[model samples]
Target: MNVSVELTFTPLQNEYEPPISAFIKRVRASGFTVLENPLSTQVYGDYDGVMHMLTKEIKNSLSNIDIGLFQMKIVKTDRSSYVADF
Candidate 1:
């Protein structure tokens, strides 16, 4: 089933923007495109797809950088469109 995941990473200093960009790239490579900015990235894809990308790829990509994932809020949705309902 499709799901919506709202992932908010703790703001890294301006220096970490590069890491964030890299993180975004890795996520995109995993099939979880960004629906919002990396500061508060909102992504849509299969639940497993997101989970795999978030847990496996995101951390690995940013491990060398001084960054941490503060919050990851996931919610299931019956429809793909979020604007009309949310």
Candidate 2:
């Protein structure tokens, strides 16, 4: 099954932009279709692949920074059906 996720990363530091930017870049580089917004980033792809990549990247990001928050809302559906185009 495919999946879609709305993810938000918050770094608990004075300088937060770099970590957030790096996280989004890693998500994009993972090959999932990424739709970035002001609040959260939406990712779409196969369930296993998306979850696996997200887990790995989030872990890597947190390990490097050591202080941050990761939030997500996941659904077992395609992006087209889950959310309408703008």
Candidate 3:
């Protein structure tokens, strides 16, 4: 199965950029389709591959921070190539 995931990482501390930036960099190196905006990041790839990468990376991110929030939404299909046609 293939999937798309939207992720938002918010670290509840003063210096938040480092962790978030690091996370984004690592995700980009994950070899998955990654889309980023100011709000969140979207990743598209095989379900297992995406999940596995996220599972490891998310944990790494959390462990580096004292406290943080990881918001995620998993879609049944890949929306990486989606375009607005409205």
Candidate 4:
């Protein structure tokens, strides 16, 4: 099955940019479909593939920090093609 994931990583340290930027960069290099906005990141791919990559990356990211947060939302279908019409 395919899936879409939205991830907002907040590192609660004094200097927050490096970890968040590193996480996004690593996820982008993960070869999955990725979209980024100022607030969050979206990744799309097969369920297993996406989850596997996230698992590795998330662990690696959080492990390096003293405190952090990962606010994640998951959908069972890919929403990368969604175009806003208003």
Candidate 5:
């Protein structure tokens, strides 16, 4: 099944821009259709593929910073219905 998700990464550090940028880059590199906004990134793709990519990349992001927060809102639906404004 296909899925959609909104992801937010918050790094608990004084200098957080680099890590956040890197994490967004990783998400883009995963090949999923990503709509990046100021507060969150919306990803659209196959459920399994999305989950696997997120699990690996999120872990990688955390490893780099050691302390961060990952937030996600997922829905088992198509992009048009679940994600607003495409």
Candidate 6:
């Protein structure tokens, strides 16, 4: 089944956007696409694939940054469409 994961990370610094951008780029490079905004980031892909990258890779990468807020949500998609596509 297809899954969609949404994550929000609030960086503690003003220069957080670059790291967030880099993290998103890394997600895309790993074959998962993302829709990122100032407050949140969302990714859509296979369940395990999306979870692995989000919970493991993304969290690990952001751990080094001074982050203030972090939240994640995963949902099953009834259609093969991106969150932004709807």
Best by TM-score: 3
- In angstroms, give how far residue 28 of model 2 lies from its true place: 0.7
Candidate 4 per-residue lDDT, tens place, 27-78, comes to 9999999999999999999999999999999999999999999999999999
Candidate 5 ranges beyond 4 A from true positions: 80-86
User: Which residue runs does candidate 2 get wrong by more than 4 Å?
Assistant: 80-86
Structural similarity to truth (TM-score) of each candidate:
0.72, 0.89, 0.98, 0.97, 0.89, 0.71
Q: Evaluate residue 11 in candidate 2 and report its C-alpha lDDT on the 0 to 100 scale.
A: 90
RMSD of 1: 2.8
Once fitted onto the true fold, the runs of candidate 6 whose alpha carbons sit more than 4 angstroms away are 78-86
Question: lDDT (0-100) at residue 15 of candidate 2?
Answer: 93
lDDT of each: 0.67, 0.88, 0.97, 0.96, 0.89, 0.71
Query: Order of all candidates by lDDT, from best down to worst?
Result: 3, 4, 5, 2, 6, 1
The 10-residue segment of model 6 with minimum total lDDT is: 77-86
Query: Model 3 TM-score?
Result: 0.98
How many angstroms is residue 71 displaced in model 4 relative to the true structure, after the best TM-score fit? 0.5
Clashes of 4: 0
Off by over 4 Å in 3: none
Assess the local accuracy of residue 83 in candidate 3 as a C-alpha lDDT between 0 and 100. 96
User: Which residue pairs clash within candidate 2?
Assistant: none
Give one digit per residue, the lDDT tens place, for model 6 in 1-86. 78877877666888877776766677767776666667777788888777777767666666768765667887887233534745
Task: Output the better candidate (1/3) by lDDT.
Answer: 3
* Candidate 6 accuracy as TM-score: 0.71
Clashing pairs in 1: none
Instruction: Return the top candidate by lDDT.
Output: 3
How does candidate 5 fare on TM-score?
0.89
